[model samples]
Target: MVGRLRARANASMWVAPALILVLVFIYYPIIENVRLSFFSWSAFSPEPRPVGLDNYRALGSDPVFWRALGNNIGYAVVSLVFQVGLALVLAAVLEAYVGRRLRGLLRTIYFIPAVISITVAGMLFQFLYDPHIGLVNRFLGAVGLDSLQHSWLGDQDTAIWSVIAMSQWQSIGYTTMLFMVAIQRIPAELYESAHVDGAGRIRSFFVITVPMVREMTTLLVVVTISGAFLAFNEVMVMTGGGPANSSQVLGTWLYHSAFLNDDMGYAAAIATVIFVITLAASVIQLIRAQRRRVET
Candidate 1:
């Protein structure tokens, strides 16, 4: 009994640091966030008084909140449609036609964004969107579509699209490189056999490559969806969720409340809701993916 206890104690000593780290970093903040969500706290106030759901109630009536939700959904859909689809297509091309040198060069180009900070990307794009002197309008003018060039980040109607486009551009390279890597791992023999059986490039791709990369595609979908749901930094730095709050996402709104507006408790409530919604969506996707696997 003594030996067993001593052995167990020795084993637990190795886990002690990890447990303490988790308790301090993850568990502590989570508990505090939940606690704050039930109160009304501000930096100015001497106390964080218990408000008990008022923050949530306020969210129910806030049009900005609804707009943010709508924007986030739009962002997610657009990203899935353009970002991941573009990646998959590029990956397919690289797998089917590209040589080793070209593949290496393309891989380098695609990975540039993953290496750079998103904040720098956002700031760089802000300049490119400059209405009078910006590169976008300049291109439009040079192309004779001068009328089409409008305020990219400042105009209400076009600002959201501009931000979404920048985000897609930033994210696509990383995703394409990853997808291409996944596609490369698929057996050359499989393609050779398909070719031997008289399959064309498109046919072999659809018949073999597509099915092979389904797992990778699922993972990318999950990551893209999560990032879409939590998009904040770019919008904050680039747009400030502004031009009449046109591009506000839940993450930016939460930021404004927690840090800018000093409504820590209300921000906590929003964060909790964000967590729940994202969790539910992820669970649904997971269930659907499992069903898909079971079917095949």
Candidate 2:
């Protein structure tokens, strides 16, 4: 009884701060946000009117909302392909080819963008993409590719891509690091055995590395799905939903409606939908991962 009591006390002590923080910050805010999503209010209006399904109904018919939703999907897909895919490939190279010191040094260099704040990244991007005197345009001009040096962030067709590149620059390092860890943890014996049996690097990678890292890949996919669905910061900074709402995403649109337009109820409805979609994606990903795990 004495030992049991002491253990319990230790566990309680260890968990105390985390429990308090979760209750105060995380759970509390989540509950409040869900509550606020169902009501209508603005800056001057202190009271929120309960407009059950009207906000949702309005979003269904909103063209800007749909455009933003499409843009968010595009952002997520492109990010997944370029960001996570390239990260995986680079991580493989670093693990298989580079020495420890060199790999770590390269990783640190790549992670510099991620370590900086998003606001700073956005500001830096704005300058990099400046039409008249930007580095990208100057490089294009110098290379005799002047036709491609038009306004990047300012134009509707290219704004989202610019934001995506910015996101990729920031996030690729972390994802690459994730892949590298998973790859490094893989048993060396498997590769050694494969080498003796006539399997080349390409074949071994396909047979061993790819199958081994399925779980990490699945998790990254889930993260990408959630991040894309709830995208906000990049869109806000890079384009602010833009020259004509071309680069608008759900989060930015929600912000515009709730804060800028003072339509809290509508924003809440959008929030609720975003929450639902993200939850659905999580559930679907888990199910798929588990099925693959079982099958393998």
lDDT of 1: 0.88
Candidate 2 to truth, TM: 0.90
C-alpha positional error of residue 257 in candidate 1 after TM-score superposition, expressed in Å: 1.8
Clashes of each: 0, 0
* lDDT values for all models: 0.88, 0.88
lDDT of 1 by residue, 63-102 (tens): 9888888899999999998777878988889867799898
lDDT of 2 by residue, 64-160 (tens): 9999999888988887886678888888888888998998899899878878899899889999999998899999999999989899988989998
Task: Give me the overall lDDT of model 2.
Answer: 0.88
